[model samples]
Target: MAVCKGCGVTLQSTDPNAIGYTPKEGSEYCQRCFRLMHYDDLTVSMRTGIDPDQIIEQIAKMDALIIYVVDLFDFEAGMIPGLARKLPDKDILMVCAKRDILPDTLNHEKVARFVFARLKELNIKVKGLVLTSKLHSEGIDDVKEAIRMLGHGRPVVVMGRANSGKSTLLNNLFGQNILTSSRFPGTTLEMNQIVVDGITYIDTPGIEIENSLLMDVNESDLKTILPYKTIKPQIFQLHGDQSFAVAGLARLDLMECDHAACVWYLSDKLQVHRSKVQAADELWRKHYGELFSPVPLEENFRVSTIRKNLSKMDIVIDGLGWASVSGQISTISVRAPKSVNVTFRKAML
Candidate 1:
């Protein structure tokens, strides 16, 4: 049986509704990959079926260098927890992708330091770290050099969360779009290998992020939610009580606070509506699908009350951007979809 050149699924002439179906013989790509490449259409949602633990187990048996790709914009959701414990013997190189989404004014050294600090906190050890951008060539050469120095005659395995730019990074390394890359998650259904510059590289299925808005929203809303360009931080001043509804997907309510500044780092297409704390609920109920557009299919929401005494911190909504809050003392409440993860961490500015 021959596997698809784009997505590593066994090709079959039968079963048009099933995965890996091809109408003709000797097709290079599966039906799903072919449509995605030609028409930008997704035939299946790869988020539900793939087993992440099984993927890790398969990687554990391989004797190759691991190149862990992560989305710099959605770093929290992109991370695969307990990776070091599972692949303890493997030498992992963390490649932070989509660096272009963040502002260029921020120092790259500071960003690297922030990534290292987070990795140390999570106990995830890496041989080295490289920040990359698909639109820029700043770190592409560094990635190649790192792979050459660290590969040591072993195949390089690329693995990361779904839609984290794994295939895009590989294409960048190859200087062409050899693999299937799309906005849809789970583009690579199985393991596919490619040889570039005398080095073997394997592309693996993207591990699904269970607690992310990316899984909850419709595919059409992705363009508005995911940042393709540098984000222009929208700063809001809060004195007593105010609430911000982030495109009906999530809401941030400042219950009580002294003079504070909340800087939002999100897609320019999204609308951030500010209202008094008392009127927030009414406003949401009145205009959730209209004025506040692009909400999840289900209206069920989970509210998390966070009290931050730190002078500076960030409230991160998985797959969505974060808001940096700075003040003496503040009590904030985040209301979002129950499945989406909401957490706080040190400000990454």
Candidate 2:
């Protein structure tokens, strides 16, 4: 059976409305990809063909070199638990995707070291880490060289959480646009295998994200959430009670603090609203969906609050990026939608 070159689904000419439908036999691309490529029209992405855990289980059972893809901007969202325990005795290569979106002045070695340090702190074992940007064709050769040296004639498996650019990297390696790449999650529904120089490269389905804001948002909101270009840290200095609303996604309150600086690492498209506590609340209540714009509209997100104390820490909100808060702030309050994971860890800068 011939699979669609764009989405890797079995091509069929029987149904005009179904997924992977082609005009006739010998068609290389599906109608869905055809419309998406030419008219920018998107279709409903499918799931449920295979469980994400089952795919991981199969990969663990096989003797392969795992190329674990991760988004550097949304690092916390990509860290799957028990990943090391599942793939025992297998060489894991950590590919940090979307490296071009980070500030250019930052030292590369320092960033790489930070990645290794963070992974070590999480107890995830990996042979080496490579920073890549599929958009700019960066780190492609280095990644191929790593695969060549580390694979040792074993098949390669690429896996990561949704929107981690798993398909984008595959297209980069294939030297053509074969896989369907999109900003939204659930783009790849099944595992796909492609041959490169007689070796197999497997593209597994992205791990579904439960607590992500994307899960509860509209498809059009992806442009505001996903960063496409380099992001400059928005710096703020605070002394007294101050609050910030991240486009109605989360409300961050630096309450009763002596002195501190909070650096937000988020998409340039999302605006950060900063003001005094009283004004912040008034504004949030009045202009959430309007002024705050791109607000979480689907789910009626309850205002869940979480408090954390830190000297220098990264305040993470699941799918969204984190904020590096530093100084004498004894307590911080995070008010966001319920089910969204709000936690802190040692600063990863």
Candidate 3:
């Protein structure tokens, strides 16, 4: 039941060289991940818990067929270039899982287009994209038919990011919830194959990478990260040197305001720093644990000093929120984990 952090494989007490291995009272990792961590250059040969590359290599050596499932909500981050790049010879059919939770405004065609664009960025060409919600059984037959037609009698592989609902979809395909479902992240931690009639499908573990970003954070943090329900957008007007903290996960230092020049778009539940930008530092020094509290500033989440000029470039705090500048401003700096991606964008506000 405990999942491996290194490769997301399930842990078992039986085989030390098996997919799941828990060392004596210490830690657990899939056998392949253990070898990757401990033994350099030694690779998984013929067992489960194989690394993504090994999985890709296996897929590459296959007889040309697959269905790549991607979490539509986090498609950009869940991309697997190793698999996509290696399986070019095989027919690649992309399946977008979790259609039920998408905001109503999200156009299905638009999502497919976005997936295509992201795949292109990864240098992986695809034949088509299918969107589905296995929970509701939508688009199931279409995906089945697509795979059946493209696979041309070869075994079909089902691979995707962890929690993308692959197991859920598979269970639905079998008309029951045979797979275990949980509210936590990274639940499915291994590649499993289930056969229906003649087609055999392979399920791979969700791999982590630079793009895992918000995916790598703890579930509690994600409660502050992914906005599940509607959040009323908050906007704050401030004076020079205004500072604000976002659920204690991030901070914003606002300088000379031409327009609003504020950090907007945080979780509706998080408190925005409303005091003068000048008092921002004093506020943190005085009340980080007291008033300006989000998910308390943990040692693990801490980052070095953040200092950068406002410089009119839009600052985006990944997961939580972002800010846009209007008028003259100096530098604004923030410090958070290196995992959090801070990117600049044109002002959308």
Q: lDDT of all the models against the reference? A: 0.90, 0.81, 0.59
Off by over 4 Å in 3: 1-50, 81-84, 209-244, 252-277, 284-335, 343-349
lDDT of 1 by residue, 248-280 (tens): 999999867678889999999999999988999
Give me the candidate number with maximum lDDT: 1
When 1 and 3 are scored with lDDT, the better candidate is: 1
For model 1, the stretches where C-alpha displacement exceeds 4 angstroms are none
In candidate 2, the residue pairs with backbone N, CA or C atoms under 3 Å apart (3 or more residues apart, or in different chains) clash, namely none
lDDT of 2 at 87: 73
8-95, model 3: which lDDT tens digit per residue? Answer: 4667778766555766444655555555455522333321223556656666777756677776554444566565546666678878
Residue 135's lDDT within candidate 3 is: 54
Tens digit of per-residue lDDT, candidate 2, span 7-29? 67788899888877888679888
Candidates 2 and 3: which is better by lDDT? 2
Q: Relative to the unseen true structure, what is the C-alpha lDDT of residue 178 in candidate 1, on a scale of 0 to 100?
A: 81
Error of 1 at 244 (Å): 0.3
Worst 10 residues of 3 by lDDT: 40-49
